[model samples]
Target: MLNILRYLKKHVGMAVLILALLCVQAYCDLTLPKYTSDIVDVGIQQSGVERVTPNQMRDTTLEALTLFLSNEDEALLRRAYAIEDGTARLTVSDSATLDRLDQALSMPMVALYQMGQQGMEPSVLIQQSEQVGVDRETFKTQLRTQIETMADQYGAAADTMTSQMAILFVRQEYQALGVDLDALQQTYLLTTGGKMLALTLLMVAAAITAGMLASRVAASVGMELRSQVFRKVVSFGSAEIDRFSTASLITRSTNDIQQIQMVVVMLLRLVLYAPIIGIGGIVRVATTRTGMGWIIGVAVGVLLALIVVLMTVAMPKFKKMQTLIDRVNLVSREILTGLNVIRAFSREEYEEKRFDKANRDLMGTQLFTNRTMSMMMPAMMLIMNGISVLIVWAGAHGVDLGTMQVGDMIAFITYTMQIVMAFLMISVVSIMLPRAGVSAKRIQEVLDTPVSIHDPAPDKNRDESKGDWRGEVCFEDVSFRYPDAQADVLEHISFTARPGETTAIIGSTGSGKSTLLNLIPRFFDVSYGRITIDGVDIRDLSLHKLHNLLGYVPQKGVLFSGTIESNLKFGGADITDAAMTQAAAIAQADDFIQAKPEGYQSPIAQGGSNVSGGQKQRLSIARAIAKQPKVYLFDDSFSALDYKTDAALRRALSQQVKDAAVIIVAQRISTILHAQQIVVLDEGKVAGIGTHEELMASCPTYQEIARSQLSDAELGGAGA
Candidate 1:
């Protein structure tokens, strides 16, 4: 996973933008619950009277309420209100002054409002004080002292009750002032609802923009990772390719990279946002003071435990899923490529079973992991609903006891769900992370594998311009061993093929004939000794310069999807129509190419599957001939052609390629009977190096190979 994150360095700017957008989205989403509580508390319950300090009141009412306040609070309230005719209008609008006045008057307002509910008006109280032989100011002082003593006895509960009753008093004052109560309620609801709508839309916009930017970053990372893997694989030697199979490499490039892309989007969208919502919800819930914070703690703890158990059970299966997918792909490719061979052997049922086994293994692992992860949603819903029920049950007591308002209870429920949902989002991503981590490691493996074959540095490479540039390839005591092999496949091999000579290597099966020819191109570097071109080691020449001087044709012909003309001109972009036609004629492919309806424009399917074996070989030969390189290496390139076509091709090749060395690796003795030199191999060591006539006279391995394919009369004729 850390290796995969390195790709994100190139996209840091976009990542930061995504994070900022997520923060905005989180802020908007979190604030909506506060307005929801306000719409219920202020809009519906208080008759839209939000302030405990009444906005307007009659002068008699203001003076009556001030009777319960200290001298300083009375002076502050007198200054905060302005008298006009018989009414006092609140002149202070700032929250600080209103809150201070509200604090000063809340208990007094609640005490007076309770007395009025019992049918005792302030006039009645003044008459009672006169009956008791006390002045009105002294009676007011005694009433204020009684209210303060009762509030101190009730502690925090009195504060909550005081605020509720004070709002009721403010509502009655508004009615007395002839304000429209219904209009004020409607205005508060509409205003709060509008703010909620705006916040919701803003949250939606932030979410969409963040999602789009995250997807773009993920897609860019996927593209770059695929390119890097492809270039790395292209530079791999034969040994490196063999180390990681083709099917595994394909899975890594496509399926594994796709996994990383999906996780990247999730990481950007949820990983940063979940914590913001969760922690912010916790803070807001604490402020609600409903004493139900333990419910949220319990829900989050259970959610975490559930997530840990599910991931623990599914992680190993996630690891195995990618390998099983590789197996399925490998089996499918093998059956498709060898379909004809399977049918010829009457092994269709066996092949079907082979494919089914691979497919079932993959399917079974996927099903188990899916079933395990499937339990998460229902379990989360259970936890959420269960906690919700618990909150409502406990919150009902607080509401009945007059400590918590209905709107506060509703807000608490919302915040509890928000906290639970945040954990759920994080848990979902946690489950995905293990699988994506497995995929990241798989992709990283291909990128991190060291290439066994490397080109020389520019200063160390051979300069072809400084030399005569004749293609003289020499293997000087060359020995090669496959990676981790017990012994060398080619031992003490020494040979030289001049620019104007035909040097053919003929050996029985398992004698490293193709392996030896591959050495000239450095497909696998020599382990013990060096092969040189113009006295410069092949390794000392950059791959580009070395391949430019040599044309190679493998035993199995390979062609890409294009027209016949395209395949023939594949050797170099500078190859012309004349050169393509001449080269095709020399390789005896012109007859077939011209006979086709499209001729040079004839389309070839992928891997040349549309063409026959012999036609593919001829086209392969023509492609090399069109290059006109100084040396040509053919590794059993003529096995598919008939005797007549092969003989004609060799004759034309010798005439046209007199100044370039040609090396052929062949299984048939007749293919190289007339060569300028033939190298014979018994095991790994060369047994003879001479003309065919000279080899039949002196070398047993050459005599055995020649007698196996030729009649006594033909052999004697060749010797003569």
Candidate 2:
């Protein structure tokens, strides 16, 4: 959670602004119930059933007594309203503003009560001193006198202000009103008009601005964090990436990040506001001056208990839902990647059943999670209504006993709802939290993995390699091992090939030939010994410098979905048309390539699916040749070609180059019969290092492999 906070802090201003708005909204929310209490107890009920003049109404009643009330003459009020009988502004404009203003007033009054309890206010001290027969009105009279004395010094006496307010209130009267009613309307407007409008507008505008900015900031933080995670993904090696699958990691990056983002956005809008709501509920319950109002506390307690229960039930289930999403993603991926295999085997029914099982499992888990999490809302509503019933039951007795007004009951109900809803929102957030937190932890783990390889700093301590087209290659006791493998694949392998020499390695399967060849290009670092190009160790050479010196055609050829021209350009990124044609001819691929409808411009499907395996291998070889590297490692590159094409490629190659080292790994003796040297291997060890005849005569393993593939004539032809 702290990690998420740090990430979200990048958008702190937006978050803070949104939080500030929610606080304002909460202020309005808290004020409303108390205002309902005041409006019923003071405005409509206390001073009703009177046709007294507006001046008398103002002098006698508390509603008319408050300074910030608004009332209009019949005509102007009608014109300000529309024929449709609604404010011309959007609907939310009026209701939300009115709602918030009521909440604001409720807070200050609650604060007054709280201050008295804390022994920290004139009002609280006065109420305490009431024990000595100092009544509430006595303190009011004393406080009023003190204010009047201060006002005289400042030329602001209370009676003078009252007389001025009376004259001033009457002057702003609507022209259409009779004097008696007009005075009353004017007094209401004088007190509450500007303050109510300003407070409502400020709270509403702040709430809206805050919501918008917080959502934007959350999204921005999510984007930056996601990009950072992706950047880290690029640096991880195969071993590290295997800890999480492609689908799982992708889900963590996209969906998991988004979940955490929503948590951030909701927390900004709710956590601070929730506490305020709870406090307001406490204050309202505590300050209920009415008879038997203790039931409000019981109702409030039950609501809180329900929220805690729902969160506890829902959190773990939500976590399972996230894991299920990853599994669903994995299942769908496997089905798609193996679609062709499934169809060819006529197992659509089986695969469909497999997909259905995974799909249903996902649906079941999510349904459980949704049901559990959604229980919070209904559970909250039930608790709210249950408490409202209790409050009504208690308030009825208070009303009967002349201690509580009907509006007090209504206001108590409203305050209870707000408090419960705020907790309900918090509960939903609580449910979302554990799942998103788990996901955040998962993403962080991937980002924290260390990169295996890094370049040494440019200094004399590191060997520097610089060359152009020197084809000398050497392996001195070179042993290459995979991470955590039981043994080295290549052991104590000492060999060298000079420029213009064709060195062929012939061995049975699993003889470490491919692994040994992989060492030259630095695809994997040699585990035990040094492999060098010319006299420079491969590891000491920078990757860019080292890779520029050799061309490797992988055993399994791969092609991107693009034109043949584009795929070949990957070799050097700038091969000329002439060079491409020359490379194709040398690779014995020119005939079939020209046979295609678009020739060099022909589109190659992904993995060269549009072409035959032989054609794909040939194109791969052509791509390798186009680079014009000093050394070319062709690992089982000719396995797909027929004898004729194979013979032609070698013939073209021999004539085309005399200053490049060529190492070929093949299963056929005929493939390397004319090579300058051959290294035979058995298991992971080198068996014999000699020419074909020398090996045939001296090494039985080499001789036996040759006999299986060739007759006496071909075996003797190897030494011809």
Candidate 3:
């Protein structure tokens, strides 16, 4: 989580501001509950000094506005008539009347007594004069009715506000405050209830503002971290990629970042609020000076228990959910990639069964996690109610002893409730932390992986290779192995292919031809000895320099989801129209490409699934030819083409790439029989290296392979 936070400076300030807002709001919300407790304790229980016929007060305020407006309108009409007769007075008594009316109507309904002051504001008398030019009864009658209606409405407002504050109103002890205190309490209940409720709402608005701000901050920071992780993953080479695949990386970047974001924002709102409630409850308790230690103790105990339960039950479930996500992704990928195979085998039911098992497993894990987290809410409520009951019992005894005032006892009970609620909030944190922890761990794994390919030293000389890699290849005692494999896939081997020569590798199966060829591009570093191009050790030169000097068409004929032109131009960005036409002609692929509905602009599905294997292979060969590389390695690239096309392609490529060296790895001996050199392999060892005539005369392995494939006619043709 802290690691994720390190990237927050770019966009974290907004999140921080939001958190601050939510915290401020939450504090206000906390204060309202406490304030209502004060209102009930001091005004409702102890005194009636707090007084209002709320509707009458409202009506008075409205009537004040109505009277002022009526007088002003009449004064305006009189001024219009006077102006017409050129008898208007600039300093009329109407001004004085309007001033007096404005003062009365605009007096704000705020708590003067709570501000440590008391009583009504100074009175303002509005003087109705002849200049006003309005009927006095008309103003008085309208203002009176408006005042009456406002009074009725204010009463309902005050009544409803007080009732809603019931949760914060401490259980009463009316007898203890005596008559004056009791009257004051009654007056407060009637007049100040709405004021307290409104204050509570102000606090709530602040809290909501804080929650929204904090969530946005979390989201913003999460987004930055997601980008950071993705950039790192993108730069990682094949080795690092193998450790965390495409699906897992995607999950970590999105879901894990979201998890962390939520936790941070939630922490800002809820954590900040908890402390205010907790501290306020404590202060209220200590000020009341009552001994309700048992109630507090029980509340704390319940909180700790809930926390423990959440950690024990929900923690593992959180971890389990992340694992289930990986399984679900794997199933989805399988269904997509193997759609054809599944259909061919008529196993849609089998795939569905596989998916169902994975889906159910994920559901079960997530369901368990949700259930455990949810248990905290109800458990919290139960504990809170129990604390409330205990407080009433304890406060009642304190009330009887005269050691606690009725008002004080009420306030203490309010504080006791706050403590329970605060503790319940702490319990909610327990639920959130577990899931976030699991997600954090998952994210950390990707960040920690070391990129497999290390950059070479800057000081390494460029002249280490010979002749712009003019394809003078040599393998001197070369060996190679996979990362996880126990044994080498290729043993000691030695061979060379000079410029304009064709070197072909042949084996029955499981031969290291492709693996050996892959090393030339420095795709995998050699395990033993050295491989050279034009007498240059392949690794000494930069990977870019080495790869650009050669063209490789792999056995699979890789193509992206784009048009044929785009895939062909992938090898050389600067390829021209003439070059594309020439390369396609050389590979014998121009006819098919031209025949397509959109010709070279025709869309190819991912992996060239839209084209036949032969067409895809031809396009791949064409792409390599477009590069005009000094050397070309064809790893069984012609396997998909018919014998006639393959023969034609080989002949055309030989003439076009006459000056460039070519290495061919083939399963069919006929494909490479005319090569300058043919290397035969059995298992991981090189069996023979010679020309076709020399291999047929001297190498038993080569002769046996040749005899098995030939018939009387073909054998006789070769002899002739």
User: RMSDs, each prediction?
Assistant: 2.1, 12.2, 14.2
- lDDT string, candidate 3, 249-320, tens digits: 778888777888877776676765677678767766776567676678777887887789788877777778
**CA displacement after TM-score superposition, residue 446 of candidate 1 (Å):** 1.1
Please give, for residues 527-636, the per-residue lDDT of candidate 1 as tens digits: 98889887789999888788888989999999999999999999889999999999999999999999999999999999999999999999999999999998999999
TM-score of each predicted structure versus truth: 0.96, 0.72, 0.71
The full ranking of all candidates by lDDT, starting with the best, is 1, 3, 2
The CA lDDT at 251 in model 1 is 91
lDDT of each: 0.90, 0.69, 0.70
Q: Report the C-alpha lDDT of model 2 over 1-720, residue by residue, as the tens digit.
A: 776777776776766667667778777766656655544543454222111112111111122112122223222222322333211211223555434433322222232323434655433343454567766555544544544454455342332233223333332221212344444444444333444566678778867777777778778878887898898876555555666789888888988898878887787776656887777766775665554445655665776677677767766777777788888888888888788998999988998898798788879878887877667667777787877788888778766644556876787777767767766767777777787788788778777777654444676223444535487999898777787888877788899988899999878899888878877776566788898788777777766666777777878777889998888777776788888899899988888889888998999887788888888898888888888888888898999989999999989988765689999999888899888889998887889998877887788788889889999777765533
Between candidates 1 and 3, the one scoring higher on TM-score is 1
TM-score of 1: 0.96
Largest TM-score belongs to which candidate? 1
Q: What clash pairs does model 1 have?
A: none
- Determine which window of 10 residues in candidate 1 has minimal summed lDDT: 121-130
Model 2 TM-score is: 0.72
* Residue 677 lDDT, candidate 1, scale 0-100: 86
Error of 1 at 547 (Å): 1.5
